[model samples]
Target: MGTSLLTNSSAMTALQTLSMTNKKLDMTQNRIATGQRVSTASDNAAYWSIATTMRSDNKALGAVQDALGLGAATIDTMYTGLNGTVEVVSEIKAKLTAARTPGVDRGKIQSEITELQKQLKNTGDSAVFNGENWISVDSNSTSYNSTKSVVSSFSRAGGVVQIDTVTVDLEAIKLYDKKADATPLTNVVTGASAGTLVAVAGNITVQVGTGATVNVATTTTSTLDSIAKDIMKLGIDGLTVAVGGGQLQFANRASVNGAPAGVTIVLNGGLTAPAALATAPATETGKGILDKSYDAYNGTAWEVFSVANIDISKLTDNAADLAKLETYIAGVDDALGSITNAATNLGAIKNRIGLQQDFVKALVDSLDRGVGQLVDADMNAESTRLQALQTQQQLGIQALSIANGASQSILSLFRG
Candidate 1:
């Protein structure tokens, strides 16, 4: 090409090449600074889009990891409480076993057992994590269905996001299940009527209240239906009875308008008392008043009973009382066995949760690696490219300067 004084063709060509080289150098510098070969849609649009989508998915995977952590914490909390309860139950069993000795001081032993029971209640109540308790249910709940799930994996399939979860079944391991007491009116008060219990002929003065009383006179031939009317006249809530198995099966309601809600069913049994003026009336010993039964779901049926129906205030050192203690020991052992099985189930669930947590961690790591592969810059390659581009940039500037000097040489050719 021919050169000119105003515009040297070689200089113009060199200027354009230098400009292109500078542009390439700028892009390489940006990549180095950002550490990403595809930072925006302008840089390899397809790769940029893929990286953007993968980054969002990685964030979702992070959330899944967090959820897994929370699930693990909940399981740990429940396991702690259940383990403590097992220990407490074991202690209670030991106490009950020791109480079986003929001369063991049961009152003292019961005091210790009572303390252990309180500990169990505390542990159950406090085993909460993130406001969730798997071992113990709320007091207001009548029953519990224990099942939980944790977010484990997130993926895209068929252009749709699919979330996977890890589930844990804690039903077999629930310890402090809140159960509603079977109401006397709903459960115990049967409509079956019965014959009157006549211990000789006498007027039975039933104390309906603290000071309020009702008198029902029964003859040797008086049927029980006649006596039930007097009980209704007292206006007791859900109170009913039928004579069966040689005893009056009475459902003493918890609420009454009279006597502050405590009722004593003491039919006058002594033969010498006058029907109208019975004195020294025989009182039903520990047979009346409100009672509550606690029930636990044992996988198939409800096991309903109060723990020992314990009342150390009334325990005696008689042989009959010792036999009662033996029965209590057996019941306590049964409770221990049931709770032990429940604890074992909880442990198994805990182990399963632990494995799921590990899986979540591994999945998160894999996701990170995948995302890295999609967008991460190779430092070695980038650094090498950066060095090469920088050298090219310097050479481009030198060439442009040399081309610009070529125009100066044209001016020299015209110089004196």
Candidate 2:
């Protein structure tokens, strides 16, 4: 028998065909098992890159959804605080109403006032969110340290934007009374003579105008305020009283001691004017306005003078306190509404995320199917192809054997 060469064309051709069939079977197996087309860059570089980018986008969207959830929490906290503040204001308004009633005991009103002040302080201090205070102290100057929790921007216009810090002025509502009601006359000498408040011992009368007069008897050391009231009540048009050098001096608003045009101060009884007079008629000063005179804080303390005292009765007139209360209530209401809106928006965003998640999931499934189409083997088809290849492979082996037999036949000639 002759040896067949290792490089025989029949052997090489069968080996090459078998190798090709094996590679195809392997690819089919990989696709069926792994369920992906672009398992590697070697499989399909372009498809793999596209799938990778899509996955990244899905992750990014999920992260943004998480951030929106956090915003919702912050808004919830703010809403709670606003509601509390509104309740406090409502209570204060009620208390104020009760105190304003006629014949109400001053002590009870004072007690209520003190309580109200405490509540106000609490309201200003208690409203907080996210480790921040929301209220700011009210002062003439614009800037100050704030203690209220301020909700900054959480707007959704393409993206969430933060707003500038807002601070509530709690002290803007606090009220106080001012001292010193009347202005005193200036530039006069008062001792025992010259500008003496008393002409003789133990008797005195200060005349404001021709018919207007203030009689002060038996009382000494009366403040300028005490004497000015008598002069004002006289209805003297322009005449006023001022204390200069211990003497009650009469002067007019016009030129020194001169009345307003036709107005005049005429003295009756034993009253007599000093030869020399003083300039600068006394002017009404201090908290002349009623509103500014009352202590808004406790509502108890007030100026003793008229006009300077704020009419506490006015607060109950339905025209005054209602509008003011409503104004404050509206602010709280608006804040609460904003919080609700924020929550709603956040919920919508979350819903969108959920939809996106569902879509992404579906997209992933579709992409997987597409990948399967590219690489996965249909088991039925692969099984049939495998059988065909097996048969061909067997036939190639038989044919190679036959070809070797031919080479054997060539050796038979030598055998003969």
Candidate 3:
């Protein structure tokens, strides 16, 4: 090649090498300072994008964690309330058992029962968490009962993000139905005309003043007059039962208030046709004091406890009322069983929530490690690379300067 001092090709080659080396050095410095291999989309678009999306998913998982915590707290509160209900009901059963003894003031025993029932209501109302009450029916729910759900997981496959949730059945947990606004035990039975008496086989329960539950039954072939015979037998209790003549009524004896506690004379089995009783349900402020469908012999006959079943203020010291108190005690026992089942259900859900919380924590940690793999720069490796690239940059600059001096030597050959 012909040598030309004006066009030093060697200097240009060295300058290009230095420029490339400087660019590499800058990249190493950036990796060291930012501590990330893919800090921008241009660094490694695919890895950068994957890591960006993973970070977003991690944030969503954080929200799910928060929701799980809230659900656990709510369920715990409900379980506490259910335990309280069990205790109160047990106390009520004990009081009813004590009232069974003869010569004891049943009127006073019933007053204590009334107070215990009030405590049950208080327990249900107070078992609220973040304004959510699992045991109490919501007035605004479209259905009679309500259910609940808690966020559990967030996942992304392809481009779509999906959220998973754990659902709980609230109907099984709640104590009162929507219909029982407050007075749960008050039932109104429709009474038939007294003139049309049809006596079929069935038993009648007369409850008064926390006393024994007096049960009277009639045979299928028996007439209303036979039921009257049964009623007369109870007169010694300071209360009287009147059956037949299209009506069944109970009234306090002359010694007591002399008012009727309840009366039911339906045709089909025990339940009166809704349409038939609509016109004339035994009434005192729009409800009957007696449970029309309840049977003294059948345990399942009594479904729920009502607040108006026995009024202490209106009880009489009659033999009939004292006998009816026995049946009431049995009814209370049935109610306790139901509350215990509900509490068990809440406990099961609480355990599940705790497990979900643990899983979420582990998942978050795994995701952080995954994100690190996609973009995190190793400090040990990057720090060493930074030094090596800096040395190459200095050597390349020196080589370029030495190459440019070769042109100056050619100029010296023609120097004066």
Candidate 4:
């Protein structure tokens, strides 16, 4: 083309090529330095956005892993306590069995049992982690929640994020629950003929909560409702009577008055007793290791007892005391079964948390790989490109120098 001092075409072409080469070399060096192909939105917006979001999600998954770890620790604590309680309850059962011997020193056996019961309480109370105690709790507390939730996973779908949780029902596994109000003594009489008092020639005496006994002639033909009404008519303090489902329920709520008492029903001659009279107080706090009522009938009377309050000290070789001891053994066995089941459940939860921990770690690794694929620079490729660009930049500089020399040649021609 035309050679002019102000606009030399060859020099302009060489300078443009060198400038382009320098730009490419700078870009290659940046990739090598940062070790990323798409470090910013300007490089590759879609991929960068995806990688950024995935990184954020991975952080949330890390938090979920932490939560799972905390939950596992809590479960471990509960399981440890429950397992110890099972051993203590088993020992108590053995003592009750030993007490069944004809004239064994039951008072000494009871002393051992009392120590074991204390151990159970201590275990339940101390099984706490992170201020959370599942074994021993107050169900009546305002902040109490029966279901405990543990964060297990964080997921994103269609740009929406959600956290998943694993739940444990404390109600099914708790060993003790303190109540705000005292539970009363209850007697339930149930059978096909429970609601009917057959006409006979005797008197029935009912005494409730230190109140005066009420006498009602057995000859009076009465339904369960009439009997309940008659008992309520006496204005016995803290007493309630209700009849339903072929059953007569009598409750003495004297515990609310600071004195807990039992109910006694005496049947005088010729009157057939109800089919079954379960003389057990309703489940109450401080009554037992487990909230269940057990019946111990001593010929003329049925008494209520529990694993924690059973009086094996009074047991003897007599049939009545033997029967009572049998009931105590059965109640203790039930409590043991409950504790074992709770431990099993806690173990299952621990295993599930372990599995989830593994899965979350795997998921975090996968996300890292995915983000790396989108943004990370291949060092080998970047280094090779860097070498090639440096070579091109040197060649472009030489070509520009040659083009500028053409202007010198033009000056020589003018001088000639």
Candidate 3 whole-model C-alpha lDDT, 0 to 1: 0.63
Query: Per-residue lDDT for 88-170 in model 4, tens only?
Result: 78888999888888878998998888887778778889999999998888877899988999999999999898998989988
Question: Once superposed on the true structure, which residue ranges of model 1 sit more than 4 Å away at CA?
Answer: 5-7, 98-108, 139-146, 167-171, 177-179, 183-304, 308-331, 409-416
lDDT of each: 0.59, 0.42, 0.63, 0.73
Clashes (N, CA, C under 3 Å) per candidate: 2, 14, 15, 0
Clashing pairs in 4: none
Stretch of 10 with least lDDT, candidate 4:
269-278
Model 2, range 1-416, lDDT digits (tens) per residue?
Answer: 44465546666676677677767767766765675545777888887765665455445445444543443454344444444444444554455455545455535554654565465445545545555432322333355332322332222244444333333332222111233434333222233445343323233344433434345442355343344444544544334344433444443332224232222332322344433322434543222111111111112111121211212433433423433333223323333343344334434544554554455456556655555565454677666766776777677677667765655565666884
Instruction: Give the lDDT of residue 367 in candidate 2.
Output: 53
- TM-score of model 4 vs. true structure: 0.75
TM-score of each: 0.63, 0.39, 0.67, 0.75
Question: How far off is residue 219 in model 2, in Å?
Answer: 47
* True-structure lDDT of candidate 1: 0.59
Candidate 2 regions off by >4 Å? 1-7, 105-416
- Best-to-worst TM-score order: 4, 3, 1, 2
What's the TM for model 1?
0.63
Q: Using lDDT as the measure, what is the rank order of every candidate, best first?
A: 4, 3, 1, 2
Q: How close to the true structure is residue 158 of candidate 4, measured as C-alpha lDDT?
A: 94
Best by TM-score: 4
Best by lDDT: 4
Native-to-model Cα distance after best TM-score fit, residue 239 in candidate 4, in Å:
21
Clashes of 3: 15
lDDT tens per residue, model 1, 257-341: 3122445555653322212212211222111111123222222222334453443324466644553454454445555665677
